[model samples]
Target chain A: MTKTELFNQIKTKKSYLCVGLDTDIKKIPKHLLSSEDPVFEFNKAIIDATSDLCVSYKPNIAFYEAMGPKGWQSLAKTLEYIPKDCFSIADAKRGDIGNTSSLYARAFFDKSASGMSFDSITVAPYMGKDSVSPFLEFENKWVILLALTSNEGGKDFQNLELAEGTEVYKKVLEVSKNWGDSERLMYVVGATRAEKLREIRAIVPDSFLLVPGVGAQGGSLFEVSKYGMNATCGLLVNSSRGIIYASSGEDFAEKAREEAQKIQTEMAEYLDQFLK
Target chain B: MTKTELFNQIKTKKSYLCVGLDTDIKKIPKHLLSSEDPVFEFNKAIIDATSDLCVSYKPNIAFYEAMGPKGWQSLAKTLEYIPKDCFSIADAKRGDIGNTSSLYARAFFDKSASGMSFDSITVAPYMGKDSVSPFLEFENKWVILLALTSNEGGKDFQNLELAEGTEVYKKVLEVSKNWGDSERLMYVVGATRAEKLREIRAIVPDSFLLVPGVGAQGGSLFEVSKYGMNATCGLLVNSSRGIIYASSGEDFAEKAREEAQKIQTEMAEYLDQFLK
Candidate 1:
């Protein structure tokens, strides 16, 4: 998916929230345990409940992967359940050698190969050109490279200043831009790093950003939107536990919708402000 | 598995080859499509043929995730078929917020929760402490962090010289050591960067190194072994396509075994030298 298409969705839906499907089987309602694939059942419910409120749905690969085969089934099913207009992301932070990355691109973007095609996939930029170029090779598909993350250790390296007077994360954003244009490339700048969003925006003003660490992680939507947003409202603020596992009881899906609604409501206001 | 356990297995098998099960459905033998799960069937045959010759199996999650739910099942089954003595890695490069990462840890390390318990997972270290800590919470499990990768773009930011008199990747290795002991953590130093491996060893001498790019990516196992090996033979050199997709025909599995044997024979020599 291109940044322009993502922007159009943001404007049309009036929401920037990317509901994170970090589904955990243990955290799902007890009733789902008996289903053939409880994780998928939970994901389907969450998608059905919150689809209208969010512009995108990001199913983190780790949550699905933990379940072994069942988790993968859940992820595929979850993608199928997600509204096609709502951007889908395989939150699989994959980056490797060029040839290997090409296969990974085929796996995620080529429906014939993997049967699960996501709009985008989270990629780690540490591997450089050969690792990232393969993901960008797919036409119109997006590559969300890791920038300044929301975690505490993000300070360990990302925030470190180089002799060139730029931070490591900033350099990652700058150099990775050469691989693909803003249309096919996005960045994962953690929502918790809201303060850095301003600096990040200056680096890649036209690119869309898959921002995690909102909601349950204490990253403020208002702060991120105000500082990071571009003319097109280029952000997909993700909320995983806050939306998917909002309630562990039978009303979990309802609770998830309610949580997602609250975020979307706020996102609508952000879009309105940006449009103005 | 602990570093000692991994080291002992490498010594006993006389191989440092960590055959990467980056199994793609498109790349698997056509005959396997007749099976209930082609990816799993291929992985089973590959493991059956190569188990004695190699000491580790690393399954890149993207190949399994691409197939959706069915692919994951194949991965779980593949993990099950791999010999218990051989270390199994999820190769799921996952890192997120603390609570979310906790769930990820539960998903990968807690077999009761996911059915596929991998000994280690590759992690993108950009998120900082909270993102990485949750993975470390699981006892005896490991977090193989992206340090200096083998890809061409690795020099983009990882090799950038910081004001602190160290390169960005060198600093990542230095700071992340405090997060966990060598037993619980390893660094991914690409085999293509063999010359720099000596410098990396100086900083992280005891930590296990998950070295990719050794086979088809043109990284020499001989060069990597010379500079990257430690007292415990701390190297899990990976070769993905070169071994796993050695042939795309009926003899695919047999071909995989032959290709793996070639690397294993070379690795056996490396191990012999380590013992000397």
Candidate 2:
């Protein structure tokens, strides 16, 4: 999906929400375990319930990978089930050398080759530009580079003090601008550091930012919009556990929609206040 | 596999060679493509041939993942076929948040869960301590963190001036020491920067380093040993194309063995000089 198309989806939906499909087997309703593929069934319900409430769906790849080949089949099905108008993200934090990285690009972006093609894939920038440049080759496929992650580990290496008071992730943001433009590039700015969005916006104002760690991770949606919102509402605030795991009963999907609706309603108000 | 077990294998085989199973569909011989599971067939042949000379097999995950579910099945079978004594390295280079990282750990380390129990898996250290520490939870499993990569883009953020003389990778080597010890932790030092091995050794003297980019990527095996070797012969120098794709014709396995033997012979000589 093009940046303009994604922004248009947000404008029409009045929500910049990205529902994260961080599904786990043990945590899901026990009744579904008898099914051939529990992960896909769970995801299908979630997508069906909240497709209109959110602009994108981000499936954390680790959950499906844990289930092995059957899990991959489920992920492919889940990808196909998502409404085409709604952007899909393979939250597979994959990056490698030039050639190997290109293969990874094919794994996620070339649906014919890998059985799944996501609009974007979250990439860790430890290996630098070439590791990321491969994913950009596929038209309309975005590379969401990991910048200030939400996890406690994000403090370890990402926040390292470089010369001239620059942090490692900011340096990542600064130097990576040469590799690709805002049209094809995005940054994973954890919602925990909502304040830092101001600094991030100053560096790459137009590029989209995939903000994980809202709700269950204790990040406020309002603060994210207040500090991170750009002209195009350049923030994809992701909520994974809080939304998907909202209920353990048979009405799990219904409850999930309720949670997504609540967040979407709040987000629409943010769009109105920030944009208007 | 434990560090002591790995060191013993190096002593027993007198070779620290790691065969990289970067099996690509387009690159493998046409004869194998006709097989029901060509990827597995190709990996089985390579493993059967070089199982004696190489101490470990590092299957670059991209090659298998690009083929989807069947590819993962091939990887599982290949993992089962590897000799019990020989170490297995899933060159997946995967790392995420704590919960997600544990899932990745289970995907590789917990055979009961994912049907593949690699001895160690390569992890990108971008997310920091918590992201890496989860993999260390599994007994005897290892996390080989990428420090200085071989690709030209390694110069981008890895060589950044973090301080007066400290570069990003060195800082990764320094800070990561706090997360896990040499017993459970190693680093990926690309062979292109063989000179940097000496400096890397100063920071991480005892921890084993998985050095890739040998013949195909223009990294000399001798330089890697001279600077990177320690008391335990602490380096698993990998050669993917030079050995696996040595002969694309009918005698592919034989040619692969011949190429592996050539490297093994050189490695044995290094072991004698370094250990004796």
Candidate 3:
């Protein structure tokens, strides 16, 4: 999906929410185990329940991969199930050398090759330009490069100052911005570092930011929207555990909708407060 | 495989060569298309032909993933077929948050969870300690961190100097060395940057270095061995296309063996010249 299309979806929904599908087999309701593909069944329910409450769905690829071939099958099915109106993110965190990365781009963007194609795939920037440029070659497909991540270890290297007097993550932002425009490229900035959003927005004011670390990770949606929102409302604040696993009972899907509704309502208020 | 066992294999074979199975379906010989699983059939023949000539097999995960679930099945069979004496590497280059990284660890390290177990897996260090530490928790499994990559884009951010006066990749080596001992940790210092090996050696002198970019990528065996080799012959120089795609016809396996033999012969000389 194009950046304008993504923003239109946000405006229509009155939410910049990107629900994360970090589904764990061990954590899901035991009753779903009777099904042939429990992971897919669970995701189907979650997507059905909350599709209208969010503008995008980010499936953490590791969760499906941990289950082996069957996991991949479930992942393929889930990708197919996500509504075309809602943007899809593979969240695969894949990047390699020029040739190898082209194959990765094919895997995620060319559904004919990999049985699944996402609107965007998260990529690591450690390998730099060539590793990331391959994904950008597929017109309209997005590359969400990792910036300031939410995890505790995120500070280990990302926060270190470069000799030119900028942090590593800042340098990553400055250098990588030229690789693709706001139309084709986005950044992953953790919501836990909400204060940094103001500084980050200054660097790439128009580019979208995929913000994880809300709710369960203790990032306030209000603060994130205040500092991160752009004229086009270029912010995709993601919530996984806080919404999907809200209830483990048979009403799991229903309860998930409730949690998503709570976030969407708040997001609507923020859209009015910030964008109006 | 343990570090001592890996070194012993190098001593026994007199070769630190790592044969990379970057098997692309389009690149393999047409005759293999008749098989139920052409990718697996190709890998099986290559493993049988070159297992003796190399001490390790690093399967580039992107190629397998491009084919989807079937590709993963081929990968599982290929991993199981590799000889017991040879070390195995899943060149997946995967790393995520703490919990997500644990799932990635299970995907590569636990046979029961992911249907394929590798002795080591390549990891990207951009996310820092937590993203990498989960993989280290697995006993006897290895984490070969991407230090100085062989690609042209490796210089993009890795060569950036920190405010503290050290390069980013050098700081990665210094800080991450404490994450795991040499027994369970390794670094990927590309043969393309053979000169940097000497400086990298000063930081983590005893840890094994998985060096790619030999042959097809224009890296020299003699140069890498001279600067990178240690008391244990601590280097696994990888050659993917140079050996595996040496011949694209019926004699492909035999030609692969011949190419691997050529590298093995040179590695033997390096072992003698450097270690003796």
What TM-score would each prediction reach against the true structure? 0.89, 0.98, 0.99
Candidate 3 chain B minimal-lDDT segment of 10 residues: B190-199
Candidate ranking (TM-score, best to worst): 3, 2, 1
What is the lDDT, from 0 to 100, of the residue B67 in candidate 1? 66
Q: Model 3, which residues run further than 4 Å from truth?
A: A191-195, B191-195
Scanning candidate 2 chain B in windows of ten residues, the lowest lDDT window is B190-199
lDDT of 3 by residue, B1-276 (tens): 899999999999989999999999999999999899999999999998999889999999999999898889999999999998999999999999999999999899888888988999999999999999999999999999999898989999999999999999999999999999999999998854455777898999999999999989998888889888899988999999999999999999999999999989988888989972
Q: Which tens-of-lDDT digit does each residue in B128-189 have in candidate 1?
A: 77788999988889998888887777777778899878888888899889999899999888
lDDT of 2 at A67: 82
Model 3 Cα lDDT, one tens digit per residue, A56-154: 999999998898898999999999999999999999999999999999998889989999889999999999999999999998999999999999999
Shift of residue B77 alpha carbon in model 2, Å: 0.7
Clashing residue pairs in candidate 2 (N, C-alpha, C atoms within 3 angstroms): none
Better of 1 and 2 by TM-score: 2
Tell me how candidate 3 scores on lDDT.
Answer: 0.93
Candidate 2, residue A181: how far the Cα is off, in Å: 1.4
Candidate 2 regions off by >4 Å? A191-194, B191-195
User: For model 1, which pairs clash?
Assistant: A69-B72, A69-B73, A72-B69, A73-B69, A128-B153, A129-B153, A153-B128, A153-B129, A154-B127, A154-B128
Best by DockQ: 3
